[model samples]
Target: MTKDHVNYVYDPVVLKGRNTEHPVHPLILSRSSPREMSGEDIPDRELMALFDAARWAPSYRNAQPWRFLYAKRSTVHWQKFLDIVKPANQAWCHTASALVVVVAHKWTVDRETGKPKEIPTASFDTGAACMALALEGSGRDLVVHCMFGMDFEKAYKVFGIDRDRDGVQCMIAVGKRPALTVRDREPRVSQRNPIESFAFEGGFVKVYHK
Candidate 1:
């Protein structure tokens, strides 16, 4: 167990964005994903608060089809959750206070037809829930990091789900931010592309221009 990591309390990296860029909340600007973490254990009440935020996210047809499986660092299931992480991620994930598996139900039975049909936005809806959960974690002064570097097949078996009915989306690790050394030694902030590059206006394939 990497419980001793709490002693390496490195200063947090501050991410600041100019207000002139956009009228965004400070929380949105300060949010960041850093690899190093202090291995302090989060209480159950605080953990539940994060999930509560996820539960309130909007979903199509009110399905809200997201499910989560989580384990605290001190629990028996902790190692099981860690096993699915990619090698590169484990370098920091091992010290997280809690690990989570985010799953999306791929299909649902229609009330009228009584036959199962694929939920077109299942994954997207789940992503929205995950984001809500992350932001909530941030509000509580906790650092949240989502990682796709997990073995989906292994997770499917570990979580005991049928591939046809459910999709193993990703994992979320939560804890206090770690020292810069826990991540790439040379810690430099990453930049998102300017709005015009990805956001489009009038038509598909057309980017928004200032």
Candidate 2:
């Protein structure tokens, strides 16, 4: 099929703002990690902006332990990035606009106490940064999909990563949202569990049932 015909198959969905006070909508709730992606290129500046948003995330002891190694979708470097993923993920991730290798350093010294500190909290800090990146991507009409299907040992060797001192947390596929058909993308709408099901009142004393 021609490019035009392919484009016709997936039309973009226009979303409008919803009332924020009416509990988080299902769209926010139903946001799932996208597996399949299209080969749409995202601007380098925009990617940088997303990382800037992640930079503002709070960290334990102010130790910002997250680091990202990224490559644009069509570059030669992208091939190296793709090689690290498992075969199953490689099939879909090959079409992503960008692949980001998320890493975290495992230790940091405490500035206040002037004592040696272990970076045991690096994973939490990295997770917070990933959330920031995702929210920023959502604001920019982009989707961020995080994945763990990678050979960390091989990746460390290939990327010259010190796995003992640093950790490979996850990989993120960032790109524009695609027009999905009912058969291709089921549930067309995102859904979420009720807040009462997960939320608790006053230190988990009782379930917060509505």
TM-score of 2: 0.75
Off by over 4 Å in 2: 1-22, 25-30, 113-116, 179-210
lDDT tens digits by residue: candidate 2, 1-210: 222211111122322222233655444433445555557898887788779879899998788999999999778898899889999988878888999999998888778888767787899999999988876676665767898899888879988998777899999988866676222543344444655666777766455446
Off by over 4 Å in 1: 1-20, 178-187, 206-210
Q: lDDT of each prediction vs. the true structure? A: 0.80, 0.74
Model 1 residue-pair collision total:
2
Encode model 1's per-residue lDDT on 59-148: one tens digit a residue.
877778899999999999999999999999998889899999999988877878999878889999999999999877776667789999
RMSD of 2: 7.5
Best candidate (score: lDDT):
1
Clashes per prediction?
2, 0
